[model samples]
Target: MKPLVMRIVFWSVLVAALAILAGVVYEQYGRYRAARDFPAPGKMVDIGGGRRIQLDCRGAGSPTVVFEDGLSIDGSLSWAAVQPAVAQRTRACSYSRAGLMWSDASNAPRSAKQVAQDLREALMRAGERGPFVLVGQSLGGLYATTFTRYFGSEVAGLVLVDPSHPDQVARVAAFMTETRSLRSRIAVSLAWTGLLRAAAPSLLPQAPNQTEHDAQAVRAFAPKSMVTQMAEGDATDAVLAEAGAFRDLGSRPLVVLTAMAPYTGSELRGMQITPEQGVQVQAIWEKMHEEMAAWSSRSAHRLLPKAGHDIQFDDPRAVVEAVLSVVEAVRAEGGTPPG
Candidate 1:
């Protein structure tokens, strides 16, 4: 009886090993196929050290609208809703930081300063010169601000969407560590194993047309990108602090868009946020947004009543109009046109 049980256990272990191996190989093959099918849409611009960052620019005119995505989100993909529309009015460029879909991974730790430098170099190399109207969402706001600080003369306008406050980590460290940071780290780790592939829905679900839908075929499960995203998430404290240093935007046409909608029941539960905590979070977020608006003397704080955190996807028209308004305002000023 003992020998029989031992043989059974050995076989069980062997079978499990085979299954995991098969899953890994299968997922890798799928990734190779996806890459072949959906190559990066834009040019891969070299940003020093022979490392490349993807820059997808559309339409024409000035000042050029440059997009920076949230920390964990796809840089160009997340701007699906608003880019094309804004492109129609003036040139719009969506750029992926190092280690995103088409961008090369960076050996150095992720920081707002590095992102700002990388973008500045890439734009100059790509000949996508300023004056740029920078549009940043979530953590991208930090990168955008850092860029403006380093090259304020080149920036014509700014739009921050539900931006991350420098003090946000300090304000809700416990909540972020307990809920978002842990969950995100785990999810990103699982992505490499193809575990999150099943849950990888359309990067932009509210995509109006099939073209936009098909364009978002890239997956977020690449090992390099996953590591990069986790690194950025981990370094939020430093990034936010770096962004906080440059508060004064002078007279740039700044528009701060805040998502004021209540979190859905599922979202609340997912974040493990209690009703009281939810209220507190909203108040803190709005207060921080107001303070960010005050950074620019010519800034306006616009509240989105129905939009959620991803205002671009939730209210594309609103985002488009906001971007166009800023672009038109800058152009009206007769700023130096892109060379």
Candidate 2:
């Protein structure tokens, strides 16, 4: 009886191990196929140190409009809903940051300053000249702020879509009994082991097209992608601290879009925050967004009534219009490219 029981236990363990190995192999094969079938639609430019970043540019005219992605999101896909429309009006470009999507992974520190510098190098190498109208969403907003601070002359306009404020982490953490940092750590760990990839849906329901679906799959499971994201998350405080030292935009053309809808009680509960705490979160987010708008004397602050944090996905038309307004403002001020 004991021998029979031991045999059963050993067989069960062997089956489970084989299943996990099969899942890992399947996911790896899927990643390889996705990369081959849906190659980058734009040029891969060497930023420096033999590392390459993907940059996709469309249309023509300048000051060029550059789109930057939110944290961990694909730079090119995040702007899908708005970029094509903006490109019709002016030269528009979106790029993958180091270690995201089609870009090569980097060992550099993942702070806003470092990211902004990388972008500057990529733009120069790609010959995407600017007096750029820089558009950023979420954490990309921090990079935009840093870029404007260091390369103010190169940026002709700025549009921030439901932007993340430098003080967001500390302020929001103060209100929550538990933060999402631990969850993020676990998720990244699972990604590294390919467990998340094995479980994640092959196609994102929210993905509007095949290109975006492939991009989402790559981002969802890539260990290097998660490492870059974790690095940025860990450096948020330091990035925000440095952001505080930069001077305001003064009279730069700026537009700040603020999302007003708070998470529902159930949604807050799912995140382990009480409904009351969720209210506080929304209030603080709005307050911080208002402060961001105040950075530029010429800025316009628009409250998006029903939009969530990813306003580009929720209400892309709003983002498109905001960017066009900035482009028109720059062109009106004779910030066009030289003939």
Candidate 3:
């Protein structure tokens, strides 16, 4: 009886050891997969701070148009309709901000102002002579407006696609877990981290790579870049506060496109937005349109009935039309339309 008990204990220990070893192997494999599948971006430029931004430059003409992505995505190629359409009339560019898709990592804070400043430098260094029409989506809209405010006359026009209001910084802050509710915030953060870890094992590419080649393409694109910039302590609120003051943005011919429908996708399926809250946000945007119209007689709003936040993706035609309209409006205003 004593011998049998000892043998059973030994077997249990061996099985536990094997399980531990398997966990280690799985972790290593997950990391390997992430590194191998990073996105392949075109045209890289080192803009100081040991960081490089990936850019896509094409077309040629006056009133060059620059496209900016949303929170954590960078696929300029995705702007198939608008880029080509506008490029026919003027120089055009679409690029990934640092940490998205094919761009290099940067320790810089991801504020709208910082992004706008980086864009200016990129244009200068890249020899993209302005009279530029800056176009941005979502948070990119904040950057676009901020860019116009900072650059002033250098920018001829501005376009915003359902931009996040500076006021939204307050809303998001009130809800974000870190400042308001630590437990909830930590839980949310842990869930995101765990999801990535689990997906990393089977989601990434088999072979390791120098550039981002992981199945978690969004992760490879955003993790290192945005976290350092926008995800820092109440930074989003600070950026939005600065964005709230739009006195300087009034100088340019601005166009605002709004999405009227509710988000129904898997990502926002269970998001809790009270009916009153939805009405209030919509009202605020409507008021913003009125402010925009008052800001410039030429500033107008176009509603996209079936589109979501990423209007560029959901309704590229609408995006293209808005851009083209701006180009034409600027020309009509004698604002030096792109040649």
Give per-model TM-scores.
0.89, 0.87, 0.73
C-alpha lDDT values of all predictions: 0.79, 0.79, 0.64
Worst 10 residues of 3 by lDDT: 206-215
Scored against the true structure, residue 244 in model 3 reaches a CA lDDT of: 75
Candidate 2 structure quality by residue, lDDT tens digits, 178-207: 345676678667663466565455423454
For model 3, residues 1-339, the per-residue Cα lDDT tens digits are: 999999999999999878667655654564455456654444776677777666777887677889876664334544544686778777888877655555565567556778777777767777777787888877677777788777866778878887766665444443222233454344335333443345433533332221233224544433333333335334666666777787456546778888776645432323345555555655666566556545554577888878777677678788888988887777777775321
Decoy 2 TM-score against native:
0.87
Local error of candidate 1 at residue 91 (angstroms): 0.8
User: In candidate 2, which residue pairs clash?
Assistant: none
Q: Is candidate 1 or candidate 3 better by TM-score?
A: 1
Q: Residues 33-106, candidate 1, lDDT per residue (tens digit)?
A: 76787677688997779799889999999889999999754557778778889989888999878887778888
